[model samples]
Target: MMDDFLTVIALIISLNAVICLYRAAVGPTTQDRVLGVNIVGTKALVVVVLVTFIQTESFFLDVALVYALLLFVVTVAVSRYLEAEGWKEVA
Candidate 1:
């Protein structure tokens, strides 16, 4: 019963991630796009953690931790790159 509940919650989080994907793709501003991507990554991390619980596996938790670190690095890199662009507008 708890497994079923976790599965349902994971599915809901996945759906939310998909919805955030649209914002990542269609956001009007670069900052908004970055935020959307970060949100999606966060949701994915949550799903991975949920899977770890559902499957009673310890490896998935490690994978989730690595993925979360990767997500943070990428988001910071992109945000810094954008910031360093210094008010330049893409034509």
Candidate 2:
């Protein structure tokens, strides 16, 4: 019973991730897109953890931890690039 409930919740989170992907694709500003991507990444991490529980596998948790770290790094790097004074877009 608990497993079924968790599976349902994971499905819901995956749906939200799809919505976040749309936001990332259509956001008017770089920050908005970055925020959307970050949200999607978080949702993905949640899904991974849920899978770890559902499947009784410990490896997915480790994967989730690594994914979280990568997500944080990417978000910080993008934010820094956006905030840099002299960054230029290449045509």
Candidate 3:
């Protein structure tokens, strides 16, 4: 029962991730695209964790950790790039 639930949730997450990926690809601005990328990365991380749990494997956890680290690095890089491009605090 629990496995079935996980499978369903995984499918949902995968679907949403794909949609977010499309958003990242077609965003009107770099900042919008970066935000979409961040969201997709986050969803991917969650899906990885769920797969690890469903399969009872430690290897997928390692993959998830690496992905999470990469996601962090990419998000930070995007923020730095935006800041460098004259994007300033709007308040």
Candidate number of the best lDDT: 2
Off by over 4 Å in 2: 88-91
Q: What ranges in model 1 sit over 4 Å off? A: 86-88
TM-score of every candidate relative to the true structure: 0.91, 0.91, 0.84
27-74: candidate 3 lDDT, tens digit per residue: 877788889989998999999999998998989999999999999999
Backbone clashes per model, in order? 0, 0, 0
> What tens-digit string does per-residue lDDT give for candidate 1 at 13-64?
9999999999989888888899999999999999999999999999999999
Candidates ranked by lDDT: 2, 1, 3
Q: How displaced is residue 9 in candidate 3, in Å?
A: 0.4
lDDT of 3 at 19: 91
* C-alpha local distance difference test of each model: 0.93, 0.94, 0.90
Q: 1-91 in candidate 2: lDDT tens per residue? A: 9999999999999999998899899888878899999999999999999999999999999999999999999999999989999877532
lDDT of 3: 0.90
Model 1 lDDT at residue 80: 86
- Indicate whether candidate 2 or candidate 3 has the larger TM-score: 2
Better of 1 and 3 by lDDT: 1
